[model samples]
Target: MKRTVDVSFPVGPVHPCWKEPARVKCETRGEYVLRAEVELGYMKKGIERIMKGRPWQEVMFLAERVCGICSVVHNMVFIETMEKISGIAPAERAAYLRVVANELDRIQSHLLANFSYCYTIEHETLGMYLLDLREKVMDLLEKLTGARVNKAYMVPGGVRFDIGEETRHAILGSIPRIREETKRYRGMFSGGPMIGLRSKGVGILSREDAGRCHAVGPTARASGIAVDCRQRHPTYMKLGFSPVVRDEGDNFARVMVRFDEAIQSLSLVQQCLERLPEGPVLAGGICRAGETVHRGEAPRGELSYFVKTDEYGRIAEISIQTPSIMNIEAAAHYMMTGAVSLADVTSIFISADPCIACTER
Candidate 1:
């Protein structure tokens, strides 16, 4: 199994594996990958820098643009950072509403990632089914937030507006369907021979490596790392959140983690609806000058935002640490271990669920 000639290939700035442009320069020996170098910046917009000196109110829209798949969480993290610094307290109902919106976002995001993973494995029918099911979540979001992708519904004090009676009912009613559909898909993905053959025991990442690389979200959880921002975040803490961890640390495990999370997210959304309090969705508060760091569990993983504000209540600086950067880097290392087949590289990369738009930003 030795390489007779050196070979280099690139999976790239325009590849099916990623929604945004990113390049992976891989060196291979025969059928095995010897090393991999991930090249980002193709989608870089210097988002953090762009937020600097912008009005605090305007930053929310800009933050949502960082990544479409997890836009709601991005706005949530940024808004929470602003709220913490400004000492703005959201109403009890507002908090629950935020949770409802976020969990829905998480469900859709996880489904989208798993669907893409299916596509990478050439499971076209399954991928299409997942995408079609995902549209239901999108429809829910559109009804609640007025947009399918960059829902700027969250704000510093609370949500922009209350969830409509019809929207609330729509969301509540949809949970059972979401849960059922997700469970069925999960069964198909886990029990299918093709998925098991291509994923189980392949692209293995050890527990130690996951910790060393600071892997987050499902990627870290699949490796048995018990680091979920939701368990620690104040909001989910109120909701009695729990982390889903699997010890396998393989491509199959990673995909299954998202499936588990999608179901978990549906349950959470149900709770938010059941326990939603009665009060204004937005609170009244004036922006204050200060600095603070906040954390939220995006669909991907631990999303941290550090905000520094000026005396005029404008954003002075903002820093974001997205999960994809860490997880993808860890996956690259795993691929470079020299045991993985060249053909399996994309499958391994997709399992990490890299969002280059989020990473590059």
Candidate 2:
């Protein structure tokens, strides 16, 4: 007679599976996951408190520190909220450039996320390949922003600088190769035999459950929810945008959604560069006392910020709700549902692309 091994333990605060410090308590009967719970707050930085009483101009760098991975969206959302409160409009060229910077960040982020997923599934070769490809996107970002990560590029009314002729020519030359690499990776993720076998029908989050959990970004999109703030943003609308959605609501679906979005983002970058408008990038205006809200579709999902200004136009209150919060919470609950195996729990958790830095911020 064969014996069954019952297991129940925690997988973090220090674990090989996750990059950050988080605690995931997992209970299992034999090899099947019976329950799981995620404990956060190991990485909180009290950034909202720091933003209080600061000028809107100074908060841009603070917001960028919220998460190294989703820094661009955080800064953009903050700037947009401030612009709304102060009634300042960025120039058309600035808006398009903002989209370009954002999409480049999106491409790199999605690639890193997919690589993480592949690593969790023990696909080392694929992970290395993705990282190599991701380097190209990062190089482009470095050229545009002068910093590979956490670029303090956006100012109150517009970006801090403009792309020079040399950088512009380089971007134009690299688009086709980048697009080709993105398409190749997309094909590998969508139909690759190892990924399909390990991810297909695994960690299924049904459409109804997804709605109830308030999922966002590619997580919700993979579950067939079509909500992308980019499609609604005026600048992105002008550039022509659409959400990538899949109905499978499984790990494979989640990975495929990101793959498809990366391909789309490459096209968006091409559009922004080709149609690069000519004009000033900054609108330069004074801030007025007001309250406002703004949203941006980050690589992981919807990132939103609420801003309140004092009589002098200084920040009175600023609160942020990153996509990782809802996505991580909901995924913790989904981990125990259905027939998820104990071995696959980490992969499933990472599929949601939970950024603890952003979540606990």
Can you give the TM-score per candidate against the true fold? 0.96, 0.96
Candidate 2 at residue 349, lDDT? 88
Query: Model 1 — which ten-residue stretch has the worst lDDT?
Result: 1-10
Query: How high a TM-score does candidate 1 get?
Result: 0.96
Candidate with maximal TM-score: 1
Model 2 global lDDT (CA atoms, 0 to 1): 0.86
lDDT of 2 by residue, 127-198 (tens): 888999899999999999999888988887899898897998898799889888878877777777878888
Query: How many residue pairs clash in all the candidates, one count each?
Result: 0, 0
Cα lDDT tens digits for candidate 1, 69-173: 999999999888888888899888889988888988998898899999999999989999999999999998888889888788988788998887787888888
- Candidate 1's C-alpha runs over 4 A off are 1-5
Q: Model 2, residue 222: displacement in angstroms?
A: 0.2
lDDT of each: 0.87, 0.86
